[model samples]
Target: MKKENVVIITPCFNENTTVIAFLKQIEEVAGKLPFLFEVIVVDDCSSDQTLSMLQKFSFVSENITLTILPLRFNVGHQSAIYQGLLYAQHLDADKFIIMDSDGEDDPEAIAELVKFNDYDIVNVARGRRKESISFQISYYVYRFIFKIITGKILNFGNFCMIKKKVLETSCHTSFIHFAAHLSKQKVKSTSITFNRLKRIDGKSKMNLTSLVHHAFKSFVEYAEELLMVFLRIFILVILLFFGIIGVVLYKKLFTDEAILGWASTMTVNLFTAALVCVGFFVMGILLLNMISRRNQNKTEIFVKLAEKSELLNQN
Candidate 1:
């Protein structure tokens, strides 16, 4: 019986201080696994020495292979991972794993993901995040809003193992957000909880603005669903406006409680406010629809493979 091939794809940008240690940890873990593991690191046009270090790095195990893909430009985190998946599609592999180069995604979790051979996709959900209190609070609030809008709870990141069949289907779709896009797919999926670890080197690269943009991308993945939710709200507001009109008319015509010039003025003001709200909601729906169309058309982004090398210990 031949061992299956497993390709691990991790994206990094200016991670010079921690990328080498991350690869070594992966090597140590891959040597113990039963599968032939290949690591593909996608560098998102880093200006630092990250690419140089990756070009010089070596692995000790004969069963492990390393491939480096440095993009032509910085296409952000999600697009970089998508480029890796596109490249891995041509490689001879039975399974693919995606994760962050930062130590937060434990290399040891690879073993847990691979053990579940029955699942099409196995996700390592975040149990306890080790970030600051402010970051955690913001993340919790984003999750709450996401669930309320899309009716789906997002608990996992990019740390997951996917079978080859799942990869074939996923590569054809838009990956604005990896985990969220996968969640929408109807596949045999399961998740295991793992506490997120701290970075191996200095502070995180993502700031508050970047984190908020990242959260918004997840919402973009479910744009149609969000549009429907807004449409329903718009309908409810319109119905409430008509109900108010009916009450005002009853007071003016059927009873003597109507004050002079007050009923007409109130009705006109209420009508104007309702029109403004309706206009805002209609504009929102149009913008979201445009975004959804753009995403559908965005099937691929530009990327370049700067270097490729293989180090096999011939013992």
Candidate 2:
């Protein structure tokens, strides 16, 4: 039998209703595609019947391989996809696709992505985002911060495809944001335009605090660069702190009408002291990131096998 390799990985969390809708669209898309398609669905220990429902969903087609990897516990969205990517590395796939099970990423676009085997990776950039005004604003701010720290403008999410060459290393990254790790791969990245779709089921698992945390994780990956940015800013602030002090001293020394009193001295002292405190705080954060990078275990991120080919037969 002639088989061409392509795999899709999706991280599922309480997506009981949405996964079924997602797979049905995949089935429709798979029928028209020209290669063998295998799907790796990582269940991040959903507290609902998402896993069980997926077990039932495994019987879409006998030809298509449906593997459900249920983690030992919930480890968040990116971790689930990371586990799936680690598993996909062993599949000897020609192409690997990452998308969401909440139906925000269109399954119909899979063929469009998988067609590009020229580059190591092809990311789908959203031409139209189906997000709220608040979310859009937050995402823009997040991207702006990302640009400052990493010197890269990342406009895509996990809706992308990578060849096997990129998968071997991209899967095992310590960075929580998989896209950030992929961005650092230095391989040629191709992009296509796609419109984002709304979720089919429950609300997003990420809140504002979670979004901030997610953005922070990316910065954590580029800790050295972030430390440099901090240092540069620190230098400017210190210079400004002393510049104000110099101005105060110049007025006290060189001017006749200068208000020379204890109030002025206390104010200058207060500003310099506040700057020092802020410097220590920023230094502490960078130090923590350095320590975290040193302690991160790339290979130890756990992935427990739930069911592989059994999903097809059991359903």
Write down the TM-score of every candidate.
Answer: 0.88, 0.83
**lDDT by residue for model 1 (1-315), tens:** 888899999999989969899999898888888889889998887888888788778898988989888776798898899888888888898789999998889888988888888888998999897777988889889889999988888999999999888887777765688988888988899999888888888577666787799897887788677667766765766676677678877887999886556656766766676676677567667767776575466443434442233211110
| Model 2: per-residue Cα lDDT at residue 43 | 83
- Identify the candidate with maximal TM-score: 1
lDDT of each: 0.81, 0.77
lDDT of the structure predicted as candidate 2 = 0.77
Per-residue lDDT for 236 in model 1?
69
**Could you give me the TM-score of model 2 versus the true structure?**
0.83
Stretch of 10 with least lDDT, candidate 1: 306-315
For every candidate in turn, the CA RMSD to the true structure comes to 4.3, 3.8
Worst 10 residues of 2 by lDDT: 306-315
